[model samples]
Target: MEWSRRNIWCVILLTCLVFWVMLLVGLNAVA
Candidate 1:
């Protein structure tokens, strides 16, 4: 159960990182 919880957090963090990168790219494109 602990391992599963940690894995979920890892996935969330990776998703957030990808989202931020995409957001930055979109802003750069607009600018």
Candidate 2:
């Protein structure tokens, strides 16, 4: 699959969102 500009952006945004969600959940669990 070709990594078009839109596709790359989508993957980056999705990764960022997933990372943020996991970080928040981890902090909540620790606290």
Candidate 3:
């Protein structure tokens, strides 16, 4: 159960990181 929870958090963090990177890239392109 603990492992599953940890895995879910890791995936969420990774997804958020990717989203941030994309947002930065989009802003940079706009400016």
What C-alpha RMSD separates each model from the true structure?
A: 0.5, 2.7, 0.4
Residues forming the 10-long window of minimal summed lDDT in candidate 1 = 1-10
TM-scores of the models, in the order given: 0.90, 0.88, 0.90
What is the C-alpha lDDT profile of model 1 across 1-31, one tens digit per residue? 9999999999999999999999999999999
User: What's the residue-level lDDT of 4 in candidate 3?
Assistant: 100
lDDT of each: 1.00, 0.95, 1.00
Model 2: per-residue Cα lDDT over 1-31, one tens digit each: 5669889999999999999999999999999
Candidate 1 Cα misplacement greater than 4 A, ranges: none
Candidate 1: clashing pairs of residues: none
RMSD of model 1 against the true structure: 0.5
Can you give the lDDT of residue 18 in candidate 3?
Answer: 100
Scored against the true structure, residue 5 in model 1 reaches a CA lDDT of 100
Q: Which candidate comes out best when scored by TM-score?
A: 3
